[model samples]
Target: MKVGLFIPCFVNELYPHVAMATLELLEGYGVDVAYPMEQSCCGQPLANNGDSSGACDAALRFTGVFKDFDYVVAPSGSCVSHVTHHYPWYIADNADFQRLQPRVFEIVEFLQDVLKVDKLPKPVHFPHKVSIHQSCHGLRELHHASPSELMIPYQSRLERILQLVDGIEIGQPERRDECCGFGGTFSVDEADVSVAMGRDRVAQHEATGAEYIVGADPSCLMHMGGIIRHNGRAIRPLHVVEILTGRGGAA
Candidate 1:
């Protein structure tokens, strides 16, 4: 399948190698992947911050850059969730974007739903106990797994894929679907609460004896990573794709 990759702002600027692992994994699958430099933010930050006008502009630009691809995929669940759920709010009745919306996917869902991938890379091996931190957007918005509020049963697409990785043992914290408190603008606007939430979430994961914490979206991991660093903890944070590529958290 032809793919257009959308790198979230933070991943593009700060965690570039993590971004490369994501791109490389898709390419490794023999899928034709394109990274459009013309791409910008998914308008999530703008929209989340109550700037619908700016978000609309970003939305249009995103559409202009990715509309032609068979699938528009992003390493970020939060960003893709915004596009899938909120983009139409600004561009009311825009047929072009509406048609493209369903084709867009967050990377994990794209892998589970599109590629039907049944295993990790042939040579991938991550021999460590890691806990999964579910990104709120990916979990609640995209339905990545069964939310704690639901009585329904479900499976995590990301975890299922990770289960196929050799020598990789994936675990979960006490609260499976709790947010990492990095709700985009929510972190900045509610600093104390965000950190408290992060601390609590990290503590739960740490209790699992996990040497590393991994998740489909790095934004959530990034928040918890900060808490880990500040507290001088040894737990490492990583994108699932990084482990899937056998790259680990290497520089």
Candidate 2:
């Protein structure tokens, strides 16, 4: 299928490898993925900051870039959630664009739901216990948890994908669904609360004695990661897509 690859601004800049892995994973699954170099922000930052007008320009740019594709997929659930969930609210007056929002899908959701990729990348050995921090957007907004509730007693596509990686023990965190306090602009505006929440999240992960905390959202990971690093902690945060794509470590 022809797919438009939407790389969020931070993913393009700081986590380029995650985007790279996304491409590789899609291509490996026989998807005809194309990147529109002209694609820019999904305007989530501006929208979250209560500036819908600023978001409109970016949304228009985004819609123009990926409108032709059958599906728009991104590695970020938060970004996809913004476009699919929030963009409609921003452009409620524009009936044309509101209908287009449903075409967007977060990468894992696309792979699991649409493509139904049962076989994944060859398992890589990490040999360490790791905890998972489910990003709020991915879990709650995107309904990643819904499938688990329906299909089985307990199941996470993220955890199941991680299990494909050899020697990686998935540890359960104290409050698995709690936010890491990195609500994009929330981190900068409420520095103390942000750090405190991150510290608490890290402490819970550390309590599990896991070497790494893994999740799909990089923004949350980066926030908690900074706290983990600042306090001289050994725990590290990793993106679930990175781990699934077998690009988890420094190369």
Candidate 3:
């Protein structure tokens, strides 16, 4: 299958290595992939900020860029959630979005659901104890993990995927489903609250004796990581695909 890569703007510009790792992971699975340079924001920020017109412009551009691919896969559940769930709010009645939205999938979901992945990188040595930080979008919107509220029992797709790797131990934070407080613009408008929430999450993960915090969303990691660094803590925030791709320094 020819997959079109959709790296969120922040991932593209700030966390380029994560984007590269995602691509590398997919290629390692022997899937055909394409990264179109024209792709940009899925207008998530604009839509989150209630700027419909601006969001519409961005969504239209995104739809145009990945419209032709068999699948539009992104490393971020947050971005994919925005594009898949919110584009209709901005575009209202556009055909471009209708054509592209159904084919969009977050990388992990694509690998597990579409590709039926059963293994990960071999000869990888990751000895650190790591905790999973389920991004809100990934958890609730995508149901990447079974939420505490759900009566139906379902395993976390992420944790299972992580287990595919060798020499890795996974831990769950004290409160598994809580937000990291980086609700996109939530950090900017409510800086203190965001920081406190991030600090709380970092502390919870630290209590698990985890040296690294891994999640599907870099945005959450970037937020929690800032507070982690400011407090002189050694906790590392990483994207899961980084681990699977055997990105250098991961071991």
Candidate 4:
């Protein structure tokens, strides 16, 4: 099946390697992946900021750019969640929107659910402690992991995917599903509150003695990585694709 690779604008600009890693990982599975150069934002920022007109334009552009693919996959859960759940606000849930809805998928869910990837085609040997950071959209919208409030038996698609690595040990934080405070435009509007939440998340991960904090969203990783560097902390923030592709991290 032909797949379209949708790299969020933040990831394309700030973390291009993550996009490359995602492409590499998918190509390894023998899936035909295409990256449309005309692609832009998924209108998440505009929608979050209440600019309905601007967001509608973006939503239309995104649909035109990616409508032909059988599946549109991105490494970020937030962007994918926005396209699947929020796009209907700007664009009608007509034939195009309905077809695109089920076709769009976050990389983790695409790999686990669609591809049925139990393990990597090539084995990865990380040999380090990693704490999983469940981003708000990934946790609540995509249902990547069972939220703590539900009080159900804990389960994580991210954790399960990481377990496939040869020597990786999973670390648990005190507050497992708390947000990193990088809620799209939320971080910029409330910088002080955002920094405080990020610091608290960093401290929680540090308490577990994890060397790396991994998650599906680069926005979350970027937020925590800045805080970790400023505080001279030992923890490293990594996009989950970095580990899965075994590229440019403590391997």
TM-scores vs. true structure, each candidate: 0.96, 0.91, 0.96, 0.97
Question: Highest TM-score among the candidates is held by which one?
Answer: 4
Select the stronger candidate by TM-score from 1 and 4.
4
Each model's lDDT comes to 0.86, 0.83, 0.88, 0.91
User: Which candidate would rank higher by lDDT, 1 or 3?
Assistant: 3
Model 4: per-residue lDDT, tens digit, 1-251?
99999999989999999999999999999999999999988989999999999998998899989899999999999999999999988887557777888999999999999999988968898988989899889899999999998978788999999988888999878899898888777898999999999999999999998999999999999999999899999889888888988873643
In terms of lDDT, the best-performing candidate is 4
Candidate 1 colliding pairs:
none
Error of 4 at 153 (Å): 3.5
lDDT of 3 by residue, 126-193 (tens): 77788999999989998999987788887898899888878888999998889999999999999999
Q: How many clashes does the backbone of model 3 have?
A: 0
Ranking according to TM-score, highest score first: 4, 1, 3, 2
The better candidate by TM-score, 3 or 4, is: 4
How do the residues 139-246 of candidate 2 rate in per-residue lDDT, one tens digit apiece?
878876643334555557688777678878998788767788999999999999999999999999999989888888888988998898799998888887777777
**For model 1, how many clashes?**
0
- What shift in Å separates residue 21 of candidate 4 from its native position after superposition? 0.5
**Over the full model, what C-alpha lDDT does candidate 2 score relative to the true structure?**
0.83
> Model 1: per-residue lDDT, tens digit, 114-218?
998887655776778988888888888899888888888877877887887878788889988788888877888998999999999999999889888888887
Clashing pairs in 3: none
